[model samples]
Target: MILHILDEEKFLKKAIQIFNDILPKDNVYLIGVNNKKSEIFHERIQLDNMFYVETGSSRYKRVFQEYAERADIIFFHNLYKSYKLNLYSLIPNNTKNVWYLWGAEIYGLNPRINNILPLTQKAYNSNLPLLKLLRKRVLSKIKKNYEWHLFKKILTNKIDYVLTNISEDIDLLESYIPNGTSKGWFTYFSFSEQNFEDRIVLKRNNILIGNSSSETNNHIDTFELIRGKDISQRKVYVPLSYGDEEYKRVVISEGRRLFKDKMVPLTEFLHLDEYNSIINGCSILIMNHKRQQAFNTIMMAIAAGCKVFLRDENTIYSCLKREGFLVFSVQKDFGGEDAMNPLTEKEMLRNISLCQQLYKYSTVKSRIKQQILSILDEQDKT
Candidate 1:
């Protein structure tokens, strides 16, 4: 059996589906979330053939160690102190291990943890100088130091493969991961192969800026960039449903201050239907993440035929552009008349088609199956 150690995330549902579809059999244990929330979340994810351990119980040890050591392969979706149960060292030396380099595990290794406080113009830290000092000098260091220990101890020590959406991220972690760890690429979503006829249209109507209150979204800078433009014809919507609480307040304050009543701040997490409603209604989507974040929303916006804007610095921009998707850059292509225009019908159709073909579940499943089978074959030979 292959054991999948997952974080409590929406993507895991898709991951579970893909794994179950490809792997002969699999067991899943979701950690990185409160045990109290487990059953409800399990229902929410609509999970099966899986389990999670209560926080204070010894069940984790008995469960994790038993299946972990017995499994033919181990897949880590996140790195956390739960290592006390599923230590990479405890698994059989022959067990093929694949570490999915989800963005947080990689960024946690950064001292800043992808903090975008600078773009807030000191509005956040200025009010909480003492709090900022504690975070900068004490808390941040402690967090990164612990994560560095995990990086050196588990990730670099014996992991066989590293999986990420971007090769550039693999390059970024080159120095930290061991030389022998091979690369495998995976994106969270799988697109449908169904053919559909819908013309991409952007009339510069409802606008979406940033997906969360996370500092990396740089919501303020995104706000500032579009502030100079005439948005009288547009209504700006910012998704702050989840992420940093204080940062959410900061984003909401600045967003309203800049865009006034035209700005709609999403304070509560929206259900799928409500969220999709906003996404479908919007014609323009602007994201200012310095790192690769809010990818699900970004891709959804693209598939919905929304005129998407991303920072040139984000590797996704390069990747999408390379894949022949019609995407724009926030810095060079975000302001004035030209920025608001939608793709031509041909370009829109091409983008929608390209997205489905490139990320088709059938293709992704085949790729994942091949990668897993290669490892199993290697094991057989040895």
Candidate 2:
């Protein structure tokens, strides 16, 4: 049996539902969400996302503990409350713990703010709301306090493995929890679940800037980056459906101030069909995230025959390029004379072929199953 200690994110609900269906029986669960209380979903709904829902957090704790006791393994998804999770004292020593490393927990915990372009960082810092800034400061202090407290013991003694596609994430994590968990790859974002028809590739000229209004997406910097590029015919689309609302306003204002008529801020969420249609029309998807974010969008961009650009500082950039993805670097590749040029016919065709072959649903299914089974196999052996 398994118990997943989840952080409430909308994507995780859909992802876990698919994971539950893929795995045997109802063992995998998207735990810790009370649907009625969730920001993403309202009402006392019996969605498959959570197994046990209760109004009282005390009851939720009891439920969590019950499942945890029966669990052969416990997965800490994203390390949202890593130091505060009471990891060492809570779970049985025999039970394996895996940190499903979402980029945020690491970057959000200890960010490389300097890695971002000056303009965006300034915009984010300047535009950040006072309440959020205070909250950020409090979190920063909490992170420091944890460094000398329980994190080391928990990471080294309790957590057995770090599950993520990027080893560089592990490297960064080690800087915090040194000689901690062993790292392994998980294809959570692998393209296998995608539909064949959705990737309607065209000789497009429109551009997609970033995945969200989050400061990390560097929307403000992106506007500055493409300030004088030959994009008169191209309309820039920025997804701002979620993330810091205050930052979203900043991004929207900055984007419009620079690009004016060309800037299109997606303030509302769109259906997948509608989203894919937008991507299909675009020939370029430029994600300037300083970390591994917007992977789903980037992968979809590849399938849509869009030329992708990423910051070289981001580990995924090297990983993508090494894995045969035609990812360009915004640092060196963009800010050039031919910056707006779409991928050539040969490059586009190759990217599509690779995307289809590697990220096909079957491949994703196999990859996830294999990863899951590997841990189960270890359990069996022990």
Overall lDDT per candidate, in order of appearance: 0.72, 0.73
The best candidate in terms of TM-score: 1
Runs in model 2 with CA error above 4 Å? 26-30, 34-37, 41-49, 52-56, 81-88, 111-115, 128-153, 192-200
**lDDT at residue 16 of model 1 (Cα atoms):** 75
Per-residue lDDT, model 1, residue 107, is: 62
Clashing pairs in 2: 191-359, 192-359, 192-360, 192-361
TM-score of candidate 1 relative to the true fold: 0.89
lDDT of 2 by residue, 1-382 (tens): 7777764555665456546756756364635554564544322235543564442366666666677787877877766454335545666777778778777666654533344567887887776778877776697677646644565566677788888777777787777657746677665555644554454555688999898778888877778788878779989999898877888988989889888989999987787778888888888888898877877888878877888999988877877787788879998989778778888877887877787777776777777677777887897788
Residue pairs in collision within model 1: none
Backbone clashes (count) for model 2: 4
Candidate 2: give its CA RMSD in angstroms: 3.3
